[model samples]
Target chain A: SQQGEEDPQALSIQEGENATMNCSYKTSINNLQWYRQNSGRGLVHLILIRSNEREKHSGRLRVTLDTSKKSSSLLITASRAADTASYFCATGGQKLVFGQGTRLTINP
Target chain B: SAVISQKPSRDICQRGTSLTIQCQVDSQVTMMFWYRQQPGQSLTLIATANQGSEATYESGFVIDKFPISRPNLTFSTLTVSNMSPEDSSIYLCSVEINVRQYFGPGTRLTVL
Candidate 1:
């Protein structure tokens, strides 16, 4: 079974705007990781937030995790056209289960 | 970070034919995973391969349909047996190191 479910299956935004994607999981997890995949390419690891961490940031990316709610959110500040891709959230434990990613499009 | 490579970046196969995808990691890893991504769909875990043991497949996947071999820590192979049109998808291999995982460029398989 899929452990995570991302909201807003697709998102369209203009460059310089911020993009926010939310993910909800069904079970407890040691950590939650976000990944980005370009067209016809492999997935790239973006950021990881542990259950204990409520929020974390890296450059333009911000990840917030709410263990009590079993939900997480990823925010990309000043989105760029190059950021157009599928973003996935994975919950980690004995194994990592991926969600049906959110496809983000940044219009130039 | 570890570098992962997969052979036969893409292939077009006829139904009933079989294709084996190979994955090699630059560094040894205890845990490796295989995932399949259908067109416009989320990735699904196929199995977990560990060195020196049989691969453990997911609930929906079976050994007869997708046999996996992990001979050592750095290399593994997943074979699609008796393929059909429904088997068409991108097969990816990933290796876990510490807490982060690195993925290989997937193999795009088209079964006609």
Candidate 2:
């Protein structure tokens, strides 16, 4: 069974608009990580936040983790057409279990 | 973070045959993993490859169908045996150092 479940399975936004995706997990986790995958491609690690951390930022990406709610969100600010891809959230244990993912399309 | 690489980015194989996918990491990593992503599905962990030890297979996955080899800390291979049309999927290799993981470009296999 998958530990993480992401909401709004798909999204469409204009270039330079912000896109937000949410994920919820069922169990406790030491860390939560986000990844991006192009169509029929491998995953690229985006960011990871520890259980103790509430928020993290990397360039145009901002991730917030609320362990109390067992949820996390990834926000892409000032999105670009290049940012169009599938985004997944993975909860880590012995292995990482990924969510179904959110497909984001950036209209130019 | 690590730079991971996989060979034979994509291939088409006949049913009942087998294909071996290789993964190499620039730096030694304690834990490596193989994952399968069927078309239109999320990634699923197949096994955890540990250097100098037997690989740990996940539920719904077995060693007979997906044999793995982690000869060293920096290298590993996953062989999809007795390939079937159902085996067509993307196989990815990942290395974990501490809490961070880096993935190799996947091997896209199509079993005809």
- Among all windows of 10 consecutive residues in model 2 chain A, the one with the lowest summed lDDT is A91-100
Best by DockQ: 2
- Residue B54 displacement (Å), model 1: 0.8
lDDT of 2 at A43: 90
Q: What overall lDDT goes with each candidate model?
A: 0.92, 0.93
Q: Stretches of candidate 2 above 4 Å error?
A: none
**DockQ score, prediction 2:** 0.77
Tell me the tens digit of each residue's lDDT in model 2 across B1-112. 6888998899999999999999999998878999999998899999999999999999999999999999998999999999999999999999777677788999999999
Question: TM-scores, in order shown?
Answer: 0.97, 0.97
Tens-place lDDT per residue, model 1, B2-111, is 99999989999999999999999999889899999998888888999989888899999999999999998899999999999999999999988778888999999999
lDDT of 2 by residue, A4-44 (tens): 68988999999999999999999999999999999868899
